[model samples]
Target: MQTTTLTSTWPQTLCDPSGRRQAKPRNKGCTMVIDKGIGQHAFADMLSTSGEYIDIVKFGFGTSTLYPLPVIQSKIALAIKHGITVIPGGTLLEAAVRLDLIPGFFRQVLELGFTGIEVSDGTINLSRTLRNDLIRDAKSMGLTVYTEYGKKLFGSRIDVTDFARTAEQDWACGAELVTVEARESGKGVGLFDEHGECREGDLSHILRVVPNLDRLMWEAPLKEQQVSLIKSLGPDVHLGNIPVNDIITLETMRRGLRSDTFELQQVPYSEYMI
Candidate 1:
């Protein structure tokens, strides 16, 4: 999808240090919303209001199964209309892997209008061979494959070196991006501590080691985590697991319209000219 052009109350090129783009840079940064079964009507409303800022909309966890077929279809259709990529959450894919339903999962995903797939081993163990195979299968079927690099286990901290390696492998396997899991809670998992604080040192280490930060999605559901990541990585870092309602807030932060990230933007030079 092109970098969105938003019609706003304020001028487009006003205070933004880096001007808004004709196409939003996904590698530079994007926002992925984790939806836990929002009704199609509500989903449509959200898209209408803030779809420009949303790059990906995930039917979170296994809740996609809980919705009626038409509802799921409607939501996917809504997202596609706004140029947003839609996919079922990694956990659902993990469940399919657990039940030996991989074939059916892919067919159904395409049938239901999902344009992408997430291959993850959060709750299940997938061998290296199986992981690569899944990526190849998804790609062969013309699906965008997004692999995740961390477990959903409670005490699972990132093994920085392992993550760096897996990210490279996933990209080579045709995955679009590697998501670092923080689950819904965003506590005690990946780079987050139990108190929902980011492990700054770990994040710094990964930033230095990982060849490309643009190919990663950080699942940060908390406001503090959002602020910290923006501070450390700049406003355009890809953030995932965002609540359905917080879409605007995140967008504001990215645009430097929010105080949390206002400092990230510099004053426009035109102001001084006057």
Candidate 2:
């Protein structure tokens, strides 16, 4: 009897249809996963299978706190082993800010091996001064800082002018990346309508304001939103708040392995045959 074994380099004929997906240690096209209490074994399995495609893992909302310290530590270690930057969700930080636990919060995350932290005021009104201070503080603690723009509200919208201004300010304050909020639903939020559709005009306005897409991550948790983004911005656009189960599916779309974006990145497979 004969059996087949697969290796990372096993297939040479197949390539990304778009031919534009960035490799690890990449500066752009980042995928941030929103982990909402996945167990240790499942997380390890996830890392084994899909960590390469994930750049950042955010323990969704305040769920990380719900886990035992040892469990959280183990998860962080697994992520670090896979070369993925992990962070507690921004809401966790907001809660910490309100409790005046910012310093200890930074200390605890650092001790737990989180390589990054997100500064966001999605649920609370975070003042600009405090926001800047938090970014600087996180940087001082030697943590990678990702700031978020826009608020999380039912009918909230992005004022393009405000977004442009705040994005620049975030960069100036040492934010490595600024994620646009779409909440977990990705509807009636920044750049999206109640129907969960992309507001192309607002998106266009944002594109005009930003110098490049490399530093901006759009939180698009829905399949339609993902399809729209990859189609509009190509496969290199950074996306966040991705559900854990959908990582590979989203990657397929980015690579044009899915029909929705197959044409966007279509390439001749024979071109790679040798």
TM-score of each candidate?
Answer: 0.92, 0.93
After aligning candidate 1 to the native by TM-score, how far in Å is the CA of 66 from where it should be?
Answer: 1.6
Superpose all Cα atoms of candidate 1 onto the true structure and report the RMSD in Å to 1 decimal.
4.6
Top candidate (lDDT): 2
**Candidate 1: Cα lDDT at 233:** 83
Question: If candidate 2 were superposed on the true structure by all CA atoms, what would the RMSD be?
Answer: 2.8
lDDT of 2 by residue, 1-274 (tens): 9978865583432457677778898887889999988899999989888999999999988997899999999999989888899999999999999999987898888888899999999999999999999999889888999999888988899988888888899999899999999999898988899999999999998998876468899999999999999888888889999999999999999888888987866455585765
| Local distance difference test, each candidate | 0.87, 0.89
For candidate 1, give the lDDT of residue 78. Answer: 83
